[model samples]
Target chain A: MKGADRSKLAARLAHDVGKYVARAARNMPPRGATPAMVAMLATDLYSLAGGRRASAVLAELAGPFGEGDERLATARSLLEEADRLEDRLRAAEPAAVERGRAIALEVQSLVLDFARMVASR
Target chain B: MRRLLVIEDGSEYSDFARLYLADEFEVTTARSASEALRMLAAESADAFLFDLRFDRAEPGTLVGDVDATARRLFGGDRGRALRYLQDQQGALILAELRSAGHAQPAVFVHDFPERRLANLRQLYGSVAAVASFDARAIGALLSR
Candidate 1:
């Protein structure tokens, strides 16, 4: 992909991922979704987007969650997965950007599912 | 480790917070303003997190007679009473702390909307860093 196309894709992916994350984060219980987790995800996304100083602040603001809580773990995992995909999208690696877009869709879907589960409970 | 004092009504919520924050902060929990005051008197905390409503209802000084009517209208549920208390006492407690020569701690108010949080910011915003309940906001305080 051309540089402009790549940058546009990266921005779209970030926007999509961030929207899902915020949606899930708002609905999940405090245990499942925390400010720290949100902050960490923001930091991860920022770092991927080359905002090193901003990422540093976010990293510090992130808090810990219970390791044994399944909901919290699931949220954390999704965030980490999104971060990885963001890395690929940011790098504009040969085949990875397309993969990142695919994963972004998948992650958003999973996050919506997660939000529904919490809502039901 | 940084000392963190968390004032929340529910044990489960406090426990959850402890689990999340224990790695970086030495966490202590209190359920009410009175308990928190006692704790503060004993030792200082590096930062503070307060749930806007505690489980128990304590009489508030600010909105005086209106509290009783509201409590009666709501069937005297402690949740409503406690919210009244939060608005009344949360500010008072912070003011008390400031007057006592304690260095104002980073304060995060949870379980509250931006409007209520803003009330706090209006009162103690200059004396301390008042923020809404976000881990990143808390983290920003910690970073400072």
Candidate 2:
């Protein structure tokens, strides 16, 4: 696409930061949050990669959520896995960052895949 | 007291559930699946109430958005991706549960989407009894 189109997509994704993060303990539920929140989180990561195409950004998640599947349960499992692991770490309990980060990575991948799916769809 | 485990994702519905079921069962609440599993791993609970909507713009939506975007990208044939999304969520839930080693657990839920209970049942190798805890009255009856 054109440079402006690419820039707009980034802005569209990056536009909402606060609502995206939702300041909730991984142990806390995200019922009050929306799909937009997750979308923004995905964008934040994409921005770090710098000038990546939307499809390129979603490389990690293309297999699962990237196809517009949103597999809520799978996503939930991934999200929960991350949250639980982190909660243990932050609370000074026996935390496994690797395990949690693995889950987070899955989520990040899924989110990127999702963004690509959205753009492609 | 019959024990109840609430696995929610930090949403209004989770509290809604706790409020209704707390009267009858010894309710232990976990906003995320991981927290719920933590409780489960640590102790024994009679039943579980899991909220499938874990995070906002959850994986499910990502799938849908991708499908939509792909349709735009390819200019048609979006159904395949949508189908994949529907099946994958159930697969993940089952994987998570089995990986967590939850036993023949009865589940109470509202939005499981993609009709995963069937797969969940098959994975459990037997039918897991499921109930709707969406209404206070129904929850009251089920908790009994």
Which one wins on DockQ? 1
Tens digit of lDDT per residue, candidate 2, span B1-144? 778666543443344444445566777776544555677788877755554433332444332355574576546656544434443433334345556776535453432223556666666643232222234543543444
State the lDDT of candidate 2 residue by residue for A57-118, as single tens digits. 33332333334455433545565454444445343332343343244444434433433444
Best by lDDT: 1
* lDDT at A109, model 1: 47
- Once fitted onto the true fold, the runs of candidate 1 whose alpha carbons sit more than 4 angstroms away are A1-121, B55-83, B86-89, B111-119, B126-133
A-chain TM-score per prediction? 0.37, 0.39
Evaluate model 1: give its TM-score. 0.41
As a TM-score, model 2 comes out at: 0.36
The C-alpha local distance difference test score for the whole of candidate 2 amounts to 0.42
Writing each residue's lDDT as its tens digit, candidate 1 over A1-121 gives 4544434333233222322233223222433334444343343334423344222322332222125445434444555555556555454442443343343334444433433343334
lDDT of 1 by residue, B36-66 (tens): 7688899888776654433244454332344
